[model samples]
Target: MDRFDQLRILTAIVEGGSLSEAARKLNITPSAVSKQLSQLEDRLGVRLFNRTTRKLSLTDEGGVFYERARAILADLAEAEESLASQSGQPRGRLVVDAPVAFGRYCVAPVLGEFLRANPEVHLDLRLNDRLIDPIEEGVDLVIRIGQMKDSALIGRRLSKSRRLVVASPDYLKKKGRPKTPEDLKAHACLLHSLRRPQSEWQFMKEGGGVESLSLAGAFESVDIEVIRVLAIDGLGLAQLPVWLVARDLESGALEEVLSGHLSPDPDIFTLYPSARHLSPKVRSFVDFLVERFGGERAWWATKL
Candidate 1:
């Protein structure tokens, strides 16, 4: 097998785990894939994979090769694109990933405006609560909430919104508002499994700093919208980022509980794959997000 083809197979195997799955993705048969892997290992003089029934794992040396190979492939792809004229307006399939609630209320609107501005550009926006791996999944950009830790990726902060502890008036009336962090144990605390910092339901203790309080709620949901609905129905207290509860708070569907507690505002960042120089498509899209949501009163900011 050709070295380049071998590298491709290696990447596919790393991502897809099973040889059969990798072959399916690469449009080859399982036996062909095994043959290629064996050839590549012999040529490179290293054990590339430790394969088992459940999955496949790379040898340490194999990981080093995969990283270098991936970079080389990216360079070749860039060269191919560079051969094509980049002088025209940015236009292509820009696959984006973002949190569901943020995508619906924030990214969707921005994307709509972006599409209108750049008629040539098309979007495949996948909105879910899970943290998506852009490189493996072939996503162009991702809008995320919280800190950026992965050194492999690049991130740009778009906005910040404070977290809040809120419940429906009926819920507060029934359960009584928590005056202290200790009181939270007595009430039904609806959790947003996606929110990292506030996942434990933090509170401002009387002295200083913060305290984390455990919770039991009538319902647990991964969907922010469903959590909002449950909170609106007086199911339990929900500690949500202000953006999710602002409209309800304004309309009196939700009431504040233990107001003085929430931690620092949760920062929102538009994360993209690390690159030396970003293409106009990714660059322009991230800039648009900053312009729209970077201001103090940006749309996603918490009002309550």
Candidate 2:
């Protein structure tokens, strides 16, 4: 039994959630995967997994072993990557995750150039709005916008996007424009359910102080795009990222409100699991994004 090979198989099974799925990922039959797991357990003299009809879960000892195994595998990969990096070309599969709209509009457009530049690398991009655990999901990188609450992950700020209170010209005409952040209380606001405190809006006061308002909205949705559409249709005012609503603002489909008192811009970050030796693929990709987005004058700033 190759101990390293068994470790790889064990991690694969844990990550893939089942023996069959691990087999598919490893390009082997389920029986072969099962045989390896059984052999590994026999050698160790301990049960590694608790199997049910629907799923397989790690035993207590297996859980402890898996963590150590993962670290060993990561160290081995890093050693191999260090050798590969000497050739000055990134290779292997890179799994990345980003929000849907940003991934579609900003990230996707630049991927062609990235792929063209690095012919040896293959990218697997997953677009999701939900926050994902990069380590658990086997993701190499995640592009996230807004405040990051998780301190466990390492991050690099790629760009910044301000939240703008905006509404359609028609909506503001009928509802009347708010002259101050305080006046927003009387107007119908469109809220993003995913945003923290859903109804509270934050802004910077003229006196270098921060103020927050607990607002009420006639419309709300888990999707920011939904609120954007509703706001565009004269439904209510919506505060959205400037990057997400830049085109609309430029086209006069939406007009900025209380721009003077808008909240501090949220940063765009590429997050990865905290590690001492960063993989070349992740490092190169992050550098590419920072340059593509513009280190200081990000593309989104042009719209503003």
Candidate 3:
């Protein structure tokens, strides 16, 4: 096997966590993926991974190999870029990942403009809320809404978002609007148990002190859209991301409450593998996003 191909195969296996997934990514059969890996290990004189029926785990040597392989690949890319600096246009596949609702409602419009502007660039946009490893998945950029937990990658802040406590006029009329954090518990909350329903709901007061509260509801959903529709139909209250409910708040379909005890601030960011010798495609995409979505577009701030 070619040395670089061997490294790439290993990277894919590590990222995909399944032989089938890696094989599909490489555009080959599972048998081919296995054979190539075995041959690669024999040539390297070390076992790279611990394989079982369920999943694959990298050995200590394999971890070291991953770091070296990435360095080598990055160097090769830089060398090629240096050589082709003047000759090549930004012509290649640019893969981006984003949350489903935000990607459709917000990112799609901006990216549509980008595709129109760059005729040579091909686009692949994947929308899912689950965090996927960009390097492992071969994604160039990930437009994520929260802060980075794994500080290994690079992050560019694109926008700030907030969680708002909102309910329909009918619901508030019947259940009564909450004036403080403690009051939320008395009302039925249409919760999203997907992210943080069982735990983690805090409010930041105007002077910066924080108060926490938890509410159980009759309706709980993993789907943001479901929660939105439910809340609009007056199914209790919902602590929703402002981006998801901006227009509703603007049109007064939903009314905001507890302004003094606002939820913790959330920001949107674009994450990539590394800044050093970053691909021109990655740089261009991040710049484009910041130009479009970057700035203080807090969806919670009602229009005057």
- Which of the numbered candidates is closest to the native, going by highest TM-score? 2
**lDDT (10s digit) by residue, model 1, range 203-303:** 56568777776666556777778888998999888777777777888889998776766566668888888853466677778888888888667475433
Candidate 2: how large is its RMSD?
A: 4.9
Q: Any idea what lDDT model 2 has?
A: 0.87
Top lDDT model: 2
Model 2 Cα lDDT, one tens digit per residue, 70-129 = 999988976777876787668777889999878987888779989898887779999999
Backbone clash count for every predicted candidate, in the order shown: 1, 0, 0
lDDT of candidate 1 vs native? 0.78
- Residue lDDT tens for model 3, 133-176: 88888788898877667677888887776788889999999888
Error of 3 at 117 (Å): 1.3
Which of 1 and 3 is the better model by TM-score?
A: 3
What is each predicted model's overall lDDT from 0 to 1? 0.78, 0.87, 0.80
CA shift of 129, model 1, Å: 2.1
lDDT accuracy of residue 259 in candidate 3: 67
| Residue 31 displacement in candidate 1 (angstroms) | 35
Model 3 accuracy (lDDT, Cα)? 0.80
Model 1, position 5: C-alpha lDDT score: 88
